[model samples]
Target: MSLYKTEAIVLKYYELKEADKIIVLYTRQHGKVQAVANGARKTKSRLAGSVELFTYSDFLLYQGKSLSTISQTEIINSFASLRDDLFKMAYASYVVEVVNEFTVDEEKNEPLFALLLATLYMLDRGEELELATRFFELRLLNLLGYRPQLDACVDCDLDLAKIDKVKFSSKLGGVVCADCALEDQYAMRINKGTVATMERLLEIDYKKLDRLKVPESTRQQLAKILPNYLQSIIEKKLKSLDFLKTLTMTN
Candidate 1:
């Protein structure tokens, strides 16, 4: 079998027979990979620490007939601070869940991979979780080709400056003018500030995310609308999301 090395982030890990683990990882070169790590679950194993969740590692793999084996794993970064607090851990988990659900193996999603790593690093360092989440949502949509229409109305092509109410249409993949919105009944009305917030999110980097002070009302609106829009596009429910929400409420 062929052997290779790559930089990877542990997305999740599950116990196998007794002392082995099935690890799902996102790699910089190979995209996502599912590999078996023998003896990774045993205490005092050399691979045990490197295979922990949210850790980034350099891995040596042997390509097997049924599944790849993790021959070796060297820890690159552990984000150990994340394990100290529940909020940070939960936020990081949410990010990982989204990455795991949305990405596929060997797809070469460099941007998405970078985004996840950056966000997780930030969360581990105790950045504002809400801002990080919003940044993640906007960037994720952009990556998936569901970039929202924020510049102008979908139909009338108005500058949006003249429009006070922006109607978002999942069908049209963006906002539409009141008159233009008649074409799609599923559209929801949003204020001009919310529209502007969406635009800023698209243009700005995650580091500058906190500068945009979105009101609770606008945040609530986006919290509802963006997820609904994603669900419509993704066409499936994510169970990890439910767990994330529960953790958010209790934490």
Candidate 2:
């Protein structure tokens, strides 16, 4: 067994037994890691706060045969503000859930780690939650190599600006001209405004996302399309997304 230290964000956790919990973290160096936090369930346990969802911390982990164990941890940013509000918590949950679903264990992705950290910080700081989430989703898709073609048709290679109405093929992984889209029966009609919005979301830096404004119609279009595209890629709906929709409807 070997011991190492790294920075990580707590994605999710599950009770292991009576007092221990299995923490799923997206570490800066280690990617996704599942570590046991002994006595974490007990009141006054030092690991309890550090292991909470969306907490970013530095950890000393002992690598073992089956799972690693957290030996020591220091809180980096608890993102406490996220937990204090229901809306923030729900959006934050969707962010972490996307990370958890897309990533695999022990696969290091520094860009993805940075994106997640930046996104959480933005959400916690009271940025526009829907816009931030959409930005994160677009960026995440890019990082995962599922970036959709916005500049041109995926099938005909025609410039999208020249086309009036376009369709997005989740299977083809980009936009297709109306003529080309006919070949792909699964392609869904996408508005030019929505495509522009998606492109802008992908291009803008996360720090600048606060200044970005998305119209309600565009936001609604994206809200319907992005999740379906993601589900097509991931092969299942995210539980957090369903909960998020419910929360949005109620509020």
Give all TM-scores, in the order shown: 0.88, 0.95
lDDT of 1 at 222: 77
Runs with alpha carbons beyond 4 Å of true place in candidate 1:
155-159, 179-186, 249-251
Per-residue lDDT tens digits for candidate 2, residues 95-202, read 999899999999999999999999998899887888888988999999999998888999889998898788988878889998888887888888998998899988
lDDT of 1: 0.82
Candidate 1 local lDDT, 1-251, one digit each (tens): 99999989988999999999999999988888999989988888899888888999899999888678999888889887766777787778777877787777778788888888888877876867866777787889999888987888877788788777788887777888888899989888888888888878778877776577878888767766776677677677755567667876675
For candidate 1, the TM-score is 0.88
Local distance difference test scores for all models = 0.82, 0.91
Which 10-residue span in candidate 2 carries the lowest summed lDDT? 205-214
Error of 2 at 132 (Å): 0.6
Best by lDDT: 2
Model 2 clash pairs are none
Model 1, position 206: C-alpha lDDT score: 76
